[model samples]
Target: MSVATGNPVFETVGGDASAATVTPTGRTTAGSLADLAAQVVTNTTDAGTAKANAVSALNTANSAAAQATEALSQASKAITSSSANIAGGYAALDGSGNANVPGNMAVGASNSGARSFSIGHTGLKDWIRFQFYTGTGVAANPDFVFIGMNGTGNTDGTCALQGTAFQPLSSNTMTLGSSNNAWSGITSQTAVDVISDLNDKNIIGTLGNATYADVTAKLRVVWASISGVVYTLKSGQSGRQHIGVIAQYVAAAFKAEGLDAADFGVWCSTPKKQIVTKAVDGQKIMSIEPVYETDGKTQETQETIRYAELLSLGLFCEKLERADLEARVAALESKSTSSTAA
Candidate 1:
């Protein structure tokens, strides 16, 4: 285009010169078209880059979510395992990175570590067991009762008794007698010598025969050190020894109330005064009754986990099954996809 100065020498378009030289119609510029094409390409590239960035962000977020789910699954399994250990009737390693049952089995002197044991019913034997706490001079207490109720008199038929039984001693060492009897003097006893003495002496009356029907029996050991630590042996039994002189009261109550084995649940807790009160109410046994009848503080030294604890554990396992953590993760992934598509 040329200035409207009537200059014929200046032409605007189509190789034609006119007086209206300012006209801009019917024209094309190589430089301006090239610039426009460049702008369009730049816009397309920027949009593609933005989409790629969004995808990268989404991938990172999805990875984080997966990690979180995995962590939760691991934690869930850990909790379930711990609960199972507790329900199994042996003090488990505490969550504090320590393996030990609490209460009387608590960390003892010279015993830098805790023991772990399990209990199960074999035939007519119904019993609960705990890890044997080992230490020096823990055996033989003047006030402790160490009697083994040998229903079958084998390693399996052994049960802890709260009552005293006469044990025949060949010499200074006692031997498991062929017949059932009681011994009167066992003050401080450790786990090692307790069961051996009972087995060899055969002091328990039920030796060579089954005492209770369909029961769980465990090796028994009850001890009180001069220092006031009471160690009880956990072995198989009908769990009848769970009742001391009060056995009749417990049995009668269960029968009168029509309470069955299902009604009474076993659990171990910290021992204390009025221990029996801790037993489930109306479940039959009102509280914890020692396998042995003893005075004051010794009663406080014994603790048991309840059968209810096991019942609760079963419920927890059921929850884990329903959660189906794997399924949940899959569902979360699908949802993320749908959202990103939108």
Candidate 2:
């Protein structure tokens, strides 16, 4: 370091040297031994002041921390005493067996599309509802969704998911039966009714009356086809007996009579499946609506015939035979009368 002498004034703070204090009257000249000594003294005093301030700050921080600890202890005590059942207290709990949250609980961070899930209770009904909201605003009305257990009782095994607008959910479809697996046959207690009202008919044409020859032919083939058998199913209906004619034999009988079974309304050999069911609690529930193939064609899976149509054809044979017998009687009576006159 290089030093030069000039009459520059240097500030000095020196008084009661042991205390390291400041007194503004003390001043010194530049480059003098007294001034250099005064600077060293001033630096010492500044360091002492900083140390004192640091100690005071430490004391203040300790006092604030003590107050905070006391506050936290009081709060914890309040919560424990208020509810005996809370925090391992031995008291009865609510029906849900869990502590209830005050407000709606949000689930999942809002997705990229601003959609999220929430669980809240409907105000009046006390119905607990799970919701999904779409709007970005905090006050936006959310869409109620998800499965819920309402206060009222419902039929067992019917579990459904309702979405927005209270509509049944249709997101995922289920395939009911596989190509290898088939559905069980459903039974109805009552006989199936056919609509025969005049308004239901299309007034296009009339059925031509059958001739005696046609009746005789149909009666012979149909009578042979009417044989029934008692048997059990391959899946075996628990040893129960069933009575029905073989549909294949019925079709063959019609073929023998030179009549196409396909041309008649009585023949029902087409098999179709459009039914689907939902599984709830390991039990199947038939609640899903039937969906058909897009091409409007039914899958061929069964064969059946209308017994009513076969019985009607048999009655026609009776009417024709009666007419033939009456005509013979009239001719014989006339001949007898003529013979008597001769």
Candidate 3:
């Protein structure tokens, strides 16, 4: 039955309210108390199912949160242990369980088996400095061996040996296994043998008939008196012998070897400019400042001749003297023959 707006439609006529009599719309709707009770039951079932699903989801979230907390606690413990180990000078385990010691790094060997420590650079220029203490009575002991490599793979470098109350030994001499050899003790026979070997390769000219004594005298002309006033250590030390030829003399003797005398003179003069006057133990003292070549532009790198070159020059000097003596002897012999014939 169609009902107009604001019109009340009474369903029950005389007895109880029947579902058929109480049609709320054009289509039949629930009108009895039993039907209303069944709808209430269905709503309650849906609500219960929703509440169960929410509890299940909450349980899963709580489980995940607990796992995260346990992981964070373990990480904190590891960090604390690592910090303690570092403070106590113990090696700490890295993420890969490898022991890493602080301040000490090892390469090419295990930490326990490492025999040497090395620092290297791949660039064209690199240098290392060994700084010593400057205070009085503090032993400024620094022992280092610098090995230089070239295409032929030979070790070449300078060694400075210093002692108490003495000057440093700054010469290029190779020491092998506790055997210390002095360059001054080089025998005349050894020098001759080296000259012979070089002559075979056309590296040096013939020495003719010059004696070792004659060459030694020539070399002596280039030697200057080293006073204690200049070197300080030579003041009271008598019978002291200085090895190594003067750079200027070497340059003069080996003009054909492309050595410039001006270059050698400049290098030799550098030491004079390096002198500093200072008071030590209530007495005025002068000392030459040490020069370190960081940029590689120093006189040592440019002007200093190698020991082999010095040896070659000594042999060549002998040859020149011998040739002059031969010419003089021949002239005298010729003059005597001419006088007798006249």
Which candidate has the top score in lDDT? Answer: 2
TM-score: model 2 vs. ground truth: 0.35
TM-score versus the correct structure, for each prediction: 0.21, 0.35, 0.29
How many steric overlaps are in each model, in order?
59, 1, 0
Which structure among the candidates has the greatest TM-score?
A: 2
Q: In model 3, where do residues sit more than 4 Å from their true spots?
A: 1-48, 65-69, 72-76, 81-101, 106-334, 337-342
Q: For candidate 1, write residues 46-79 as lDDT tens digits.
A: 9999999999999999999999999989977665
lDDT of 1 at 327: 76
Q: Flag regions of model 1 displaced more than 4 Å.
A: 2-31, 80-342
lDDT of each: 0.43, 0.58, 0.48
lDDT of 3 by residue, 1-342 (tens): 433443234444445544423444554553654565676799999999989999999998999999999998897666455364564456777789955666644465532222345444444233444333344664545433233332121334333323232223653353322212114333343443232354456322233334445534444343222111222224345656555545555555434444343532322233212456676656556655545466645533224444564444445655656777899999999999999999
Ranking by lDDT: 2, 3, 1
Writing each residue's lDDT as its tens digit, candidate 2 over 18-70 gives: 33322333443224445557778999999999999999999999999999999
Q: Model 2, poorest ten-residue lDDT window?
A: 1-10
